[model samples]
Target: FLRAIGKARLITPLRSEGGHRRYSRYQLRIAARARELVDQGTPIEAACRIVVLEDQLEEAQRINAEYRRAAEQADPPPAD
Candidate 1:
């Protein structure tokens, strides 16, 4: 199913010297999420797409938070 997930673009595992797939901790987490979605009755393809979108949303939110913090630092409130 990892191959299927890779083909679906949910996770991209690295290849070992012998061409074996090697997943990082992050990728494993993605796989676990996919499994969770599947257990909830989501189709495999749909689960992969959801996971990818979820990861993208999380990254966007983190960046947005950082920007907000930096902006606050640059220009604090004018008065109490």
Candidate 2:
């Protein structure tokens, strides 16, 4: 998966006392986003740019709004 997104070099294996590789939450999120974008027809470089470089604060806000609306509609409160 790392190689597929051209991040084989960036992804490093973490060593624990037991010698197990550990990945941080942020790294996992980045990998997941990369896979998603790649599957959506975005080139690896462009996917990385959009997910990592481009400012996504506004896009995040819009997504949050949509999620909140969906949650509200999913189980609306009962009438008094």
Candidate 3:
């Protein structure tokens, strides 16, 4: 499974001393999600790309929210 995904350049797990592939929690989640998408009739390549884009969009939204909070903190409202 990992080998196929690795070949597709989706989730690149690290290799241990014994040359065994080791995946992190993040990778596991991604793999599970890709599987879900594939099971939904999505193509393997498209599924991987969709998962990656979704993750990126979520991260970008999170960063934007943080920046908004920081900006609000840096500038206080007028006296009430």
Full-model lDDT, candidate 1: 0.93
Show the colliding residue pairs in model 1.
none
Which window of ten consecutive residues has the lowest lDDT sum in model 1?
1-10
Q: Give the TM-score (vs. native) of candidate 1.
A: 0.90
| lDDT values for all models | 0.93, 0.73, 0.89
**How far off is residue 45 in model 3, in Å?**
0.1
Candidate 2: lDDT over CA atoms? 0.73
- Taking the tens digit of each residue's C-alpha lDDT, what string does model 3 give over 1-80? 56767777889999999999999999999999988988899988998899899999999999999999999899977898
- State TM-scores per candidate: 0.90, 0.48, 0.92
Candidate 2, residue 62: CA error in Å?
A: 15
Model 1 regions lying over 4 Å from their true place: none
lDDT of 2 by residue, 1-80 (tens): 76554454434656799987677786677778877988999877777777665337767888999999999999898999
Global Cα lDDT for candidate 3: 0.89
Residue 80 lDDT, candidate 2, scale 0-100: 100
* Alpha carbon lDDT at 49, candidate 3: 93
Best candidate, lDDT = 1
Arrange candidates, best TM-score first.
3, 1, 2
